[model samples]
Target: MGYGKRALGGVSALALLAWAGAVHAQDEVTQVEELTVTARRQTENLQDVPAAVSAFGANSLYEDQVETVGDLQSHVPNLSLHVGDASNAVVYIRGVGQIDSISFNDPGVGVYLDDVYMGRVQGSFLDVIDPQQIEVLRGPRGTLYGRNTIGGALKFTSARPTNEVEGYLDATLGNYDDRRFKAVLGGPIASDVLLGKVAFAASRRDGYTKNLLTGEDDGDKDTIAGRISLLFRPTSDFSAYLTLDASRNSPDASRTPHRETPIYSVNTGALRPVIADPDVVEATYNDLEKLKTRGAALTLQYDRGPFTFKSITAYREMEYRTHLDLDSSPDESFGIYDFEDQDQTSQELQVLYKGERLSAVAGLFYFKENDETFAGLVGPDFFVILPGPTYFPFPANTSGLRLAENTSAAAYAQLDYKLTDRASVTVGARYTYEEKWTDNRGEWFDPAVAPSAEDMERLFRTGAGFNVTGFEAEEDWSSFTPKVAFNYQLSDDVLTYVSASKGFKSGGFNGRNTAAAQSFDPETQWSYEAGLKTELAERRVRLNLAAFYQDYKNLQLSRFAADPATGNFVAVFDNAGRANMYGLETELTAVVTPKFRIEANGAYLHSEYDEYIDGGVDISDQRHLVNAPKWSGRLSASYDLDLGDAGELTFTGGVSYRSKTYLTVSSSEVLAQDGYALLDASVVWSQPGGPWSVVVSGRNLTDERYREHAFDLTDSPGVQLGYYGAPRTYSVNVRYRF
Candidate 1:
């Protein structure tokens, strides 16, 4: 049978299990644990919520060994997460998402931690350090949480301090010289009045790629993450919590990722290297990258009879450094260095009310951010005039600087009311106002000699002298987005619902814009969906299905722009053409036998551009949306065994499959990625009534070769560039709890 048939049969078999269980195991029937979630900013049963949300508790996270957010892609359907380097963490959902790598352009999706919003994409590559839960809500959420909820929202809730003393230590070792350790401690500082927790995690790994030129590793990683949280409750109705977190990474790597040896050069039309094996690459530069991030948040809540009130105040700071060899050659024709810094602050006030037949939440949010950039591009020792072909004995360096400030204010409210005992309706609205202003400046300097540190310093004099001084631009926008939904309870174990919602993203100045036109309008999307959730056979089986159609306009797209000074391409954001997306999704989970459990999910998508224009050229009819996979799905199974005195043993395995996907907004036909599949497995052994355990994990058992990011460099001499997926990896871990 084909894969698609197998998928449908598996789901059908799960439904049939309902009747089978009704006859075989009527005496020992036990349902799967019902999960609780804060999807609507209020605690509620996951199955009772009238939305498409995927929630993973701490136990699930441990079962999958999900340390980084990127690992979620293996299990989540209709989701794509890309990490080109340590700096770019782009996320896409349901054929809609963001690929903005810089700090200026905002993301299409919103990311929140413990009710506090994160505004930058550079720092969104989160490492989970004892988070209690992670929730991924699909579809528009603008009315629930403003700003960049056009695609979806991700919520990561940290674990809180408990009255009882608790702690855990976990250590791991893997191939590629990988080493890691994590520890968590929580206890009561003063009985019931005060509590606190501390968590720390660190990891290091050798580079997957070897630098043939330098005979050293190119992408080695050394990182550390730490967090501290404290909770205070001086009164029965009043409580407060404070959290502090920081992370740092230093790698002597390059923007020149592992590149395939040239086969048939598009630029020269000549055979260069016959590379039958994709595992190896030849590179010449030993580049450098450094990053640091720090943040703090405070939350207070008070119960006031029929109403509850809460406040959140947050501050964040980030610093990033980069050095790259643009040519990726030993000749050093061109090289670049970048230094960037950012700081942000946010404040929010919330009020929630719960009545016998009505529930509501109202919130006011304010945000402010400041960002600065200083960068330089160094040219070769000898250059030539274009077309005329006259070689000049001069070296020129290009420098640029930009500083931008942003502010946003918003008010949102959502209410759910019961129209009948089995029927209900929900309505929500939000109004957001934002403003951004930026100052841009740059210059070119030449020393008329062989390029050297001294020669370049003498030409530009100092970094301060390269400032462009008198260019400034500002943009302001206001938008109102709304949501409406109707839900009905058909029976005690079945629900059906339909929703209509609008999403919006703010306008901003393109930090890399080299012209007078430096800003683009905000993007908007409207989505309509219908879904059903059912519990069959005394809760032994659960199935969820959803269908949606979405319309997007004034889409925000990231592309490369020619930099006149450096003769290279710089990232620029623009308003691309509108697009349409429609898809079907289904998920099933079942407890088939006493020792076996199975879960599966699949998504089929059809997305295309309705209108597209770039540089006065219309290409809407020929391109597909970026990052939109034609089809994707996952299937996983687990089995448990009881071994008397030897304790218990468990085995788990999963397989994920994805169809063809595009890599760029323009859908450049040459850079498309074909279909691929991955296999993963794990085994665990534990002691009875236990405090200690061991686990062995393996990923990509078949060693599938794929590309995470692929691009045909139109700006740099028609070269094809791509970042290969990680090869097969293995790890063994030990854990102790007290």
Candidate 2:
């Protein structure tokens, strides 16, 4: 059978298992455990909390070989990551996510590292290092998280230095010339006086894709990161900690070209003739990106027997620049482009208090960013194309500069009154005030000539004039969000709960304004969720299931159109739509036998735009939104075998699958990536008494070709390009505990 057929068959089989009461039977015999989470003001078991949440610890991440936050989508139901230009990633939960690419604004999903907010979307894709735990809280987290959490929040907690001295190093090498190295050390500095730790990691990978036009390597990647932390305990009542980190990334292009002809037919009159100009080929370009990020955080804690107080302050800065060839056609000269610079800085502070049954958290946040961009469309001189084309330049030069600032302050409190030992009702509310400002300037110039000083001044002044007339020319906004939840335990091994919450995304000015000035309103969402957690059969099995529905209003939509007068495309942001989403997520883990274990997780989503108006036409009630998928899931199994005196060997394998999805809101044409399942396997061997071990892993054993992202141009017919998923790869590593 073909790969597509096999994948479809597997999906059908899984669907049958889901519907034939097999999953229900498995849940009955699973034994769930108590999971502590801070989704509420006070610590409570995840099963007892009314909100929909998924939590993963260090051991689980290690077993899954997760290298980045993007990898979490496979393990968590109803979640996916969207890839876009300039390292801009959009995270979606239950079919709700923002589609804009501007970096200075907020995203539909919020991400927090050690309680410090990361305001920009581009920087959120940084590598994860030495994390103690990660929590994905689904639905509106308005009461505590505040803005830009219309979908949910991702919280990462890093491992801290301990009183005991400990350290470890890991090294790996794999197929396609991939190599990785990492080291970590931590210990007490002076008994209870101080503690410190340091961590460093580096990775390199050979290009996986071969450029058909240039025969050059693409998809290459390199990353390096380091962190230092210090903890001080002055007295039994108070303590403080400080941490600093830095990271650098240099990566090659990952863009793929659209096929000019159908793969099944050669002479179907569909293929466009390849351009023969070297300049065009060069302009069709591929380039590189270099990004650096630095951050520092300070945290203080105090305990007074019955109450605990904590305060955290943090600062972060990120710089990113890229040079890209936008046109993937064989003719390179026509589609070349470059991004000179983009940067952002943020500062935040948070304070909180916790007690037996009551807790409160408050914070202040500020962010600022400045971006300068230069781009040119290169082609042949006029004379090369037509007769008497003297001194006619084919390249068009365009440049833009933008400055943005955002500031906000918020306070929230939650009170839990235990009516009984097994039942509790929590009431929470949050209030937030915010302000935003932006300034943009743009100019179109003829780069061939060196304009006189006076001419340069004139051009700059004209650009400023355009900014005065086009931009929003002001800054400020305010909002308030609230939340409530209830929990009930049926027994020691089973719990059920429900919750309702509100979420918001801040409004921002439109950067492109060739058309009339348009103002956007903050998008809001109200979510309702219910879930059940159960454990059975001597604590050997666990099952978690949740269903949620959300109603969204004033959804921000971006529209791009060509200006007949300037012949340039203009983009504007407007609140032109509303949507509703409903979904089910289920996870199960079973230790069927002493030496064997299996896990199965899946998500099913249904979303629709109830009201959508574009260009004064109703395009509402669409079946699918761009970059949204209806079904995705993962399944895996592992076993441990005793090797006698040599110790033990552990083997693991898994497969992940995603169903077909559309690439546009209109859903006029389907990307139709026939569902694909990637096969992965790994093995680890270790000695009983030694501090040494070895591991080998392989992914995508079948090397399936699939599209990660896809889109078609508005003016072109059947002309589409997309980013392809990774190919087959393998890695081997040796590690030492001390």
Best by TM-score: 1
Tens-digit lDDT track of model 2 for 1-738: 000000111133234334333333444433333456766545667666666777777656654556778767777787777455556666778776665556534688888877777776767774667777788888888877776888888888778899988877888899878888889899899996799999898988866666666666665778899899899998988889898988887877544444422211112322344332211221235565667778888888877766667767777777766544443454322332334344445554445555555455555555555554333333221101122211222344344445555666666666666668788777777677667766665554454431221232345535332322325355567677777777788898788888788888878777554223355888889988888876555555566778888898987765444343433334556876788888887776665554566667777878888888876887785536654567888887767788998877878888988777655444545344666777888887777677777778888889877765554433222234445666788888887867
Residues 658-704, candidate 1, lDDT per residue (tens digit)? 88988866566656778988888988777777888878888898998
**Native-referenced Cα lDDT, model 1:** 0.75
Q: What is the C-alpha lDDT of each candidate?
A: 0.75, 0.64
lDDT of 2 at 104: 39
Stretches of candidate 1 exceeding 4 Å from the true structure: 1-23, 26-29, 260-277, 282-286, 333-336, 379-396, 447-470, 561-572
* All candidates: TM-score: 0.92, 0.85
Following a full C-alpha superposition, what root-mean-square deviation does model 2 have from the true structure?
6.5
